[model samples]
Target: MARWKVNLAVLCIGQFLVMSGMTMITPFLPLYIQEMGVTDPHHIALWSGFIFAGNFVTSFFFQPLWGRLSDRYGRKVMLLRSSFGMAVVMTLMGFAHDPTQLLLLRILNGVISGFMPAAVALISTNTPREKSGFAMGMLQSGGVAGSILGPFIGGLMAEWLGFRSIFYVTGALLFGASMVALFLVKEKFDLAEAKKKTNITIVEGFRVLMKVKQLPALYGVTFVIQFSMLAAMPLIPLFVQDLHGKGELLAFYAGLVGSVTGFSNMIASPLLGRWSDRIGSVKILAVCLIGAGLCYIPQALVTNIWQLFAARFMLGVFMGGMLPSVQTLIRSYTPNGMESRSYGFNSSALSLGNMMGPIIGGALSGWVSIRGIFIMSCIMLLGNALWVRRTLSDPQLPKQTIQKAGSASHSGDDT
Candidate 1:
């Protein structure tokens, strides 16, 4: 296999492990807090939201700094740095005895954790331009698969070994992933060239990148996608309860509600990526935004759990295309030697969206009703789609594809 393909495969595994380790705590986070001696139900809920958002909060601020480092030092070292740091923090969470300790540790994890963005930067910068769409699609598929499986695995491990022990196992798995990357992935980085840009401040980096007309719009697309998707997701359980009733199996039904979307997204991402390689990602992105936005309406209107399930499945199909398209477009627009920094800033936008989405959804859900919150999300996404269509530039064909087209035209003339 080519070196870029090898790196892609390595980073796909790395992304899977990173996503799994992060999400394993999701199923038992509140329960773990209760076990750690938070007795009041209200406090448990408040503390849970706070601790959960803690990671994204710090991540939102720190991604640019890491991106700049990755550009200067090499993406491989940044990958190692993040994986090891997150591994240690995840292990320490196993020993946390109180909510404050857990909260603090989660906050710290956010500060140190950034394997995905760096992996993305590595792959995007190193892979052939024609293959960026496929690489991103496959990587997203790997991460989604991990997200689908992680909760199930964590739940089983928590049942058999207890909640705290799951953290130890998660830590070990992350460490193993770092080891794999440290040995297998290859990057043809120029240390001399990289060092020349080392002194550019993050602000300066942003200034330079923003001069690319399409970049800010692409950044907004990244943020809006996350914001619109996540804002609706945290409310799925409550909406499921409304449609299905609060049976003992309600949580099971809600889990299905969420996982089915991921399942379908995994199916759709690569297909869309292939299509993007031919027709252009910007077109696919606008279509995906519109399709995903339309899919949200049925969720708000569903009268039963089955209806909701079908709606979410359709939503996933469109959702899969959104992120890979945005990532591909970002790479297409970014200048050479600054790819990592652009990805880093985009990651920050994504993290900010992640941090704010749930908070706004939670805060507004009761006032506007869950259904209303869903409507608001739908409007935001559709509006974003319009903004994307109106503002972003037309996609340029990949150089290889253009060369092939020119060759075919000359052959036709000769015939």
Candidate 2:
């Protein structure tokens, strides 16, 4: 296997473990808050949204800061730090006695959620540019796979081992990931150059970030993709309950449906990414967004759990191309030496979307059937398709221009 592939595998495994563990809390959160003595549905909804969005709020602001710091300090070190920080916070989350405590810990988790971004930056810089889409897609697949597996595992652990135990397990898994990165992930840094150059500040990076014309489109896509993706999350379990009620089949099939989506993401992500490498990110994104929109319509119409699962699986397949494509496009445009900083901005956009998705989903669920969220999601994705179509330029055009320029120069008299 190639070095990039090996690196991707290692990183993916770590991501799978970490995300699976962390996300275990999702299914049980509202119930946990209720158990903690918050009885009112409104209160539960409010607190749940707070806890859910807390990490993203902090992470959105903190990501760029961490990214720039990583650029100055080193990606490996930043990954190690974030992993360790997450381990400690997750363990503390298991021990929280109230919704307030859990919410605070979640915020702390967001503040330190840059491990994946750092890993992404490291891998992106190391891999050949032509192959970056595949590498990024592989990494994303690992996380999506974890997300797919997480709800099932989390539900089982919550039932069998207790919700508190899930936190401990999550903490331990993160700790193990940190250790693996510390010992196995190697990146040699230039101390001499580091000493000679001044580190780029967050404000400076933001200034440079604003100057990049491509950044807006990237940020817009980031927000839109996340909004579309996360809009589906809060409703998955609810939709299952609505379809099948509080039965063993509901829980079992819910897990199965969610897992199927992950399986699809795992399979489709790399293929789509590799496809993007050939076809270009803009076209792939446009197709994915439009396809995802159409797929959601069937989801809204489904009466059976199996139908919902099938729709979700299709949604996963279409959505799989999104992250890797965005990352590749960002990598293509980011100036040299500011890789982490640029990715930081990208991470912040994703975090913002993460924060927005659930709140919007939860609110929408109150107004419309759980399936209505799918309708809303479909609209969002269609909007994304339109937005991307309008803003995203063809990456291939520059290469064609370069080839044309070279041909013209060669045809002329030798200079």
Candidate 3:
């Protein structure tokens, strides 16, 4: 295998382990908080949100820092650092005796959380430009697969071994993933080049990226996609109940409805990614955005559980194409030698979206109807598709516009 291919394979497994480890707590987070002695329902909900948000809150600020370090040192080292740091934090969570301890550990986990992004930076920088879409798509599948399986595995473990054991298992998996990255991932980083760029502040880096015409728009797309997708998440179970009229197996049905999209997404990501390589990432992105946006309309209007499920599954298929295409576009536009920092900033945008999406969804579901949230999501996506269509049509926009912008900025700096 080629070195890039080998790196891809190793990173895939590492990404899977890291993602699964992160998500394993999702299935039973409230229960874990209760075990830590938070008995009030209101407090449980509050603590749950706080603990969950804690990671992303810290990660949003820290990702760029890690990305910059990755640029200076190497993506592999950043990956190892994140994996090992996460492993330690997760293991400590298993020993937490109180909500405060758990919350602090969760915050620490956020501070250390960059494994997947670092892996992305590594793969994006290392892969041949021609194969970037396929590599990123295959890489995405690993994370999706991990996310799909993590809840199931965590639920089973919680039943058999208890919640604390789930933390231990997750920690062990992360440690093993770090070991794989340490032994297998290879990089041809130009240390001299990295050294030269090290003095550039993160603010300066963003200024450089912001001058690129397409990058800000692409970041907006990331936020919109995540925001639209998640805006319906907090209401899905309630929607399922509304459709199915509630039963003892309501939770099961809701879980199934949720998993269908992930299943379809996992199946479609690599296929569409390869397709994007053959066609163009921007074209695939536009098509998928429109497709997914339309799919949400059916979901909003669905009269039955099966209809809703089908719509969500179809949405997942289009969504599978979305992120990889975005990543491909980011790669195409970013100047060489800055891939990691650029991706890091993109990751921060993604994390911000993740943090905001559910909140927006929750607020919308509260203020309006659940179905209305779906409609809102659909509108956002369709509008975003239009934005993408207009902004990203010319592939040369970045190269031409950014060069002029950079020269002008340099002149200003000189003056």
TM-score of each: 0.92, 0.84, 0.95
TM-score of decoy 3: 0.95
Residues 1-415 of candidate 2: C-alpha lDDT, one tens digit per residue:
7766666777888888777866777789998899888999999989987897788789898898788777767887888888899999999987888999999999988888887788888889888878888888999998887877787788888999887888898888889877877776767566455423324456655655566666677787878878877777766876788888787767678767757766887899999999988978778888888998899899889988878878988988987888888888777776655668778888888888887887788788888866788888888789877767776664432111112222333222211
What's the C-alpha lDDT at position 320 in model 1?
94
Candidate with the greatest lDDT versus the true structure: 3
For candidate 1, give the lDDT of residue 339: 70
Model 3 ranges with Cα > 4 A deviation: 397-415
lDDT of each: 0.83, 0.78, 0.85
What candidate 1 gets wrong by more than 4 Å, as runs, is 394-415
User: Which model, 1 or 3, shows the larger lDDT?
Assistant: 3
Cα lDDT of model 3 by residue, 1-415, tens digit: 8999999998888878877777778879999999888899999989988988898899999888888788778988898999999999999999999888998998999898888778888888889988989999999999989988988898999999999988988898888878877888898898876765454667767887887778888888888888887878878998899999966888888999989999999899999999999999998999999999899888879999999989999999999999899988987887766678788888899889899999978877777787888888888889988888887877574543333334444332211
lDDT of 1 by residue, 349-409 (tens): 9988887787788888878877887788788888988888876755552222212223333
Question: Candidate 3: which pairs clash?
Answer: none
Sort order, TM-score high to low = 3, 1, 2
RMSD for each of the candidates: 8.4, 7.6, 3.0
Q: Rate residue 171 of model 1 by lDDT.
A: 93
